[model samples]
Target: MLRLILIGLLLLVIFPVLASAAKVMSADNSHWSTARRDSTGIAPDPKTTPEAVVQVYAARAFNWRGIFGVHSWIAVKPEKAESFTRYEVEGWGVSSGRESVRIGSYRPPDAYWFGNYPELLVDIRGAEAAALIPQIAAAANSYPYRDRYTIWPGPNSNSFVAHVARNVPGLRLDLPPTAIGKDYRTDGIFGVAPSNTGLQLSLFGLAGVTLALEEGVEVNLLGLTVGIDILTPAIKLPGIGRIGFPQGPS
Candidate 1:
């Protein structure tokens, strides 16, 4: 039984990562500065729409990291706003005394992360978006790891997005399994799932189990996740992400 379990894990988890790593290695963008960061044009045009909007996006992380996980961010545009504000965390400038939490409109709301295209995880508009914007901002501002970042068992980018999702349950954000740090618990080992529909118990984000209405059942081993999303009827793999029905805004 144990051997079968190990084989299943190897097929479901390790193989996907190895396959993704092959593609990452062959990519032309050899350096971060040269990677594509253009907008994917999926976001609503704030200048023309004029409605409050909130969106969450995730993309494969830069370079080799893309093989294991992704970086995610939240973007908001209040009613009548001309631009969007994006909030995310990164480890890049932290060592040089820069805060890990970044808030600004320096880039388009749906800009690619390095050379990787982004996937929208949540979309809320108009009054609903307006109501949730402030709460999301507050959650981002209060992120406990604003000055720290750990790529593995982390308070990294995924952790930031998960934090916001937990605080603003209305978003119904369903972070993918490749979002390695989404289960990190800054306050304690036990807490509500990021989707806020169920409960989770994570040991510093490394090992955990999440059972939620939106998430279904997930198991995290060393920051890699494997599970089944009963809500969407999908299988979540560690490095390859979701497979089955398409998940998007309802």
Candidate 2:
């Protein structure tokens, strides 16, 4: 039984990435720019849009890294607000003594990430968004590893969002299975799940098991997650995200 489980875990880590390698970009898009790419115009225009909006989005990571994981960020617009605030942790500046974590509002929250269309992970509008904004901001600002970053098993981009999710249960978010390194918890080896609704045991992010309402049952091995979304009726894989037709009926 133990060997079977090991084989299953190995397959989960390898098969999806290999199968999806054809779609993963081997190089960064020439159009890689932080500027807005709002061809769909789905992002709310603060001036015309309603009050209190919050959204979480994730896009494939740059270049060959896209084969393995995604980068995620949060955006919030408070009640009667005129604009949205976007927050994310960038790895480029960490080597130069600059903080990797940043917050701004110049670009649309839903903009394509370097030619990759982002997936909307969570959206809360109106009063609920307003109520959550302050807590989210606080959690982002107070993140302990603001200046640090690691591509795997670390305080990378996914870790930031996971931290905020753990702190704010109202979000009820489960980072996508393809979101590698989302289980890197610094507080301790054993603690509550980020969704605040379950228990998790981790070995410094290299391996872990999480049982939660939002996250279901997940096993993380070397930062690759394999899980089942019992509530949503889908099997979550490492690189391909959720399978079993998670997108709804055809």
Scored by lDDT, the top model is: 1
Task: Return the clash pairs for model 2, or none.
Answer: none
Q: How accurate locally is residue 113 in candidate 2, as Cα lDDT from 0 to 100?
A: 70
Model 2, position 112, has a per-residue lDDT of: 77
What TM value does model 1 have?
A: 0.97
How many clashes in each structure?
A: 0, 0
lDDT of 1 by residue, 153-199 (tens): 89899999998899998998889899989989766899899999999
Candidate 2 lDDT over residue span 1-250, tens digit each: 9999888766887788786576785544565565336634556777887779888888888767788899998889887788778888889879889897889876778877776788887888888888999999999987889779999878888889988888888887778888877888857788888778898998978899999987889999888888898877789888888886453111
Computed on alpha carbons, the lDDT of every model, listed in order, comes to 0.90, 0.81
Please list the residue runs of candidate 2 whose C-alpha ends up more than 4 Å from where it truly belongs after superposition: 1-10, 26-40, 245-250
Off by over 4 Å in 1: none
lDDT of 1 at 206: 87
